[model samples]
Target: MWKPVPLPYKSDSLPLPAIPTAAEIRACTNVLWDGAHRIVALNEDVVVKYDGGLDATEGQNLIYLERYAPKVPAPRLYAMFEEDGKTYLILQRIPGVPLDSIWKSLTVSEKNGITAKLIPVFDAMREAACPWPDFYGGLDGGRVHHWLFYSQKKKDFKFLGPYYGEDAFVAGMLQNFRVSTERCERPDFKARFYEKYLPQVLRGHRPTLTHSDFHQKNILVIENPCPDNQGERSFEVVLIDWEDAGWYPDFWEFFMASDRNVFSFCDEDWFWHMQQFLEVWPAELGVMRLFEKDMRGH
Candidate 1:
């Protein structure tokens, strides 16, 4: 069902990463002509991937998103495949500008619309039980039911000392996971943020197709709305980047977005954004609320 649509091609000229040139992209891989992924400069579209991961499900995301097009500002996947120990995923190079560049210029209605659209798309993904949840990575799966603890591949959790500390919590969570993760975790943070807010995180939730890393960077904004034939503008949303895509706790996405990199990425605007979005989501808060509590000794 999921397949790549053939694109009309002209002379091969691809837009590459501003810093890392295509040569660098090619040089990084083992097999240039037959590598896992290499740079193919085909008219402003430069791809970075590796098909030779020995993972049969490699490049599965290209097929997943292609079949289910979310009505938002995401990338257009044009092609995907693996050959000679390398994988390739070709996508339509989105042309317009970065959302962050024009975020302030964007009307609040536009921002609200984007926030609203995510729910439906998330629902569609959950209903279908489609894996490859985000631009991160995918998991071999079928229809999922409840929250799946990462007991199987339990990686060490890092702590950022009341900031983005997944490691410390990772250690602690592995310890008294049986104990309630409520008040014992709070320190210097405010009340509603941790005590009351976080406890709700894992109370009522089941994991669906969580993007695991749906930050704004992973979410691209292409064209702004233009006056339609009837003077109305309908927004089109396209999701891109499925390397980090996978099945995991929704808090992972919320945590990464809240302020990743030891809180170097904090933004009050996004703080309010989460507050408002949480009112709508109502579920994701429980998981993230706990993380917020664990991050602060203040």
Candidate 2:
């Protein structure tokens, strides 16, 4: 179960002491100047993260999910508080480790099997309701940020390419999708495919919630607990890090999820998969559609 960790909060209002030394903090690749994630110890409970955002609303979503919904395969949020410029998520650090560390060892059948298992969870989310107003909805709660859509007259929301590391290898993968799918008419459409995919082609299929960051790192393996966990592992696939989850079409997670090498299934397989995937993809997500719409004149 992806339940939040329980902590001794409230009575202890003051922020937890810093773990000391940038060396120590820097050692954990998960740490940020905006915050930090330390192991503490193998068995030691509670992951101490520091966040500067005053509201801590973003952090609260994890807390809420950790408490209310343990069955949906998300980490538990035990306690959180904001003081100074920092916020912390005292969560039950997920047991199994990052999926990528173990992805290479999985046989082809195992890989496809894992891919198959993830679908039902996606279906479960699709059948649910979107809590937020915009297309980007949160799984636990909705509307963590102020998101504006494109206006035909205005052409809004123009940030192109991956926003974070979890958005890793997206631009490159799309480039490959274009060349392999033979839709390389326009470069910009290749970039904004998802923006068009939603509300346009996918208006009908939009169901419940989606773990927008459904990649290797955010997902944890259950049966083969990363050799590190040794024993005591439950839940074969636990979804962690509900940062950008929301109500979205299944295609958002399906075709878009890729690796540095994460492309369509086979050589010509890209064409068929792209054709099938675009059934729901926004006009912007397809290079051909983009080339036709915004790049024809050029």
Candidate 3:
């Protein structure tokens, strides 16, 4: 005798957290972070981040890293879902203080040891397989998330990309630059110079996965967690906040890490430490700074 079994119909809906859990989240008083998104500590082991509008790619990026680049220390994503115009992501709570908190007190040798460990971690990330070999974008093959593709003229504009090649990516960047220069009260002569030289300046870079925001706050460190034979404490680092992680030009990691906006404010020698781990593209960085100036009006 043959009997037919029926299973529930499947749809593309994401998993939803328990109703009580969601309710508690909305009313949770233990907020870890308050910014564009709200991060609430659910318990000792987990935290949930929710926002009215968040880039879904961030969760995907975490999954991608865990799957493809396991050596890169990052948070474990427990659950992610969308409900009622808001997105919620439950994640493992990594135990460590932010690097910036104790950076000033670290001895030069200790700093060097910490950075030495990080160099290989970044190397592993760069070495991870690209989801789309020919395209530069988010892990899901969606639009690139970097600011270069952001539309300056449009309010809350959706960035453009998943470019098929380096040339196309450069074209997208120049298009945004043009929009930014258009209808300005004063003539932006630098815009004209960038229009002419940008293609040449931006040429010959292969796409690499970049954690575009690599600052002290985003990096967590556990100091003296383990002691070796000499009774010296070993340093450990875990990187967080993958919101801006994506495929970008090879030089992007260096450029973003070297930006001075935070140099005077937090971790004064952050740039110097960044230089130790990243390959310095002096000429490209200089040109990128000029472009950053044009884009930021500095």
Candidate 4:
């Protein structure tokens, strides 16, 4: 069971740990990426991830992966601590560069080969059965960070949901969506969304372990020394950033793969190949798009 740590400050309070000082990030060179919630830096061979008093799923996910899917290549968690309401994770950095960095340089065949390598990893995830099939949430028994709640809630809001199943999860989503769009005064649109899309999404799909953010940027690749015919080089694939991983409905993988927000490299070939490698749920995606548009008030 995962224990919830009380945030040091109230919800109304401003963000904590305002931009780590030089002394705080000691020996950490070459800032990797600074996003709204966390700042990631490279400290020699280790990667340091700092979260600004919000979100505990990253560390928890790492721990879960280390125990459950040891073969799946992810950054090994070395150390973790909380200071001044902020969370810091020290991880063993994977050696290769992000796949997206070299995506444009690779030939079509090379790209396809990389996808082939990833199939086994996906298979492993699919094979790993959920300990509690009744719930739909994170590995730590927390709420899933779906786009629906993410857009409406505060950054620090601990969205820990363990909805019973797809029906419960969708109900929660609909409720939250209503709250988010209460000001719009559009009940009919909500009704239309519920009537048209909800049934299609419900399709009696079983839950499977899903790397909810399996995108090109999250995939690391290193070229194999030996090259096959056609001069296409084989590569070792390492999936990273497991913060959003959880046991989700069968269609969740397809929905997330097609999500452009995280998967920036959603090119025609990549999208097509991802569908070929895994299941594609176009109807679910259409519903998600409707929700997205509604949230954006479009």
Question: Judged by TM-score, which candidate is best?
Answer: 3
Worst 10 residues of 1 by lDDT: 156-165
User: How much is the lDDT of residue 175 in candidate 4?
Assistant: 65
Q: Candidate order by TM-score, highest to lowest?
A: 3, 4, 2, 1
lDDT of each candidate versus the true structure: 0.42, 0.44, 0.75, 0.69
C-alpha lDDT (0 to 100) for residue 126 of candidate 2: 54
Which runs of model 1 end up more than 4 angstroms from their true locations? 1-41, 44-58, 68-77, 81-86, 116-119, 130-137, 142-203, 224-235, 250-252, 260-267, 274-298
lDDT of 3 by residue, 1-298 (tens): 1111111111123233442256778898999888978888877877788884674567777777776789989987777666666667777787788988888887777788789889998888778767676578876567888787776675757888779898888878877777777745547677778878988878888888788888788889877666667555568899998988888888888888777433474636667777777777878888988888777772
Tens-place lDDT per residue, model 1, 1-298, is: 3332332211133243333333444555333235433334344554444444422232454445544534323454444444455444544665544445655565566666665655566556555543332211143332111122222222423211111223323333323332223325533334434444444344333334455545555556555458546443334455554554444444555554554422532542544554444323435544555454543322
Q: Which one wins by TM-score: 2 or 4?
A: 4
lDDT (0-100) at residue 114 of candidate 1? 61
Question: What lDDT does model 1 reach?
Answer: 0.42
Rank list by lDDT? 3, 4, 2, 1
For 160-264, candidate 4 gives per-residue lDDT tens digits of 467877777777767666666654556667755664667666668777888888778889997898998667788998888787788788888877777753344
Error of 1 at 160 (Å): 22
What lDDT does candidate 3 reach at residue 144?
83
User: How far out, in Å, is residue 133 in model 1?
Assistant: 16
**Model 1 error, position 104 (Å):** 2.5
lDDT of 4: 0.69
Count of clashes in candidate 3: 0
TM-score of 3: 0.86
For lDDT, the strongest prediction is 3
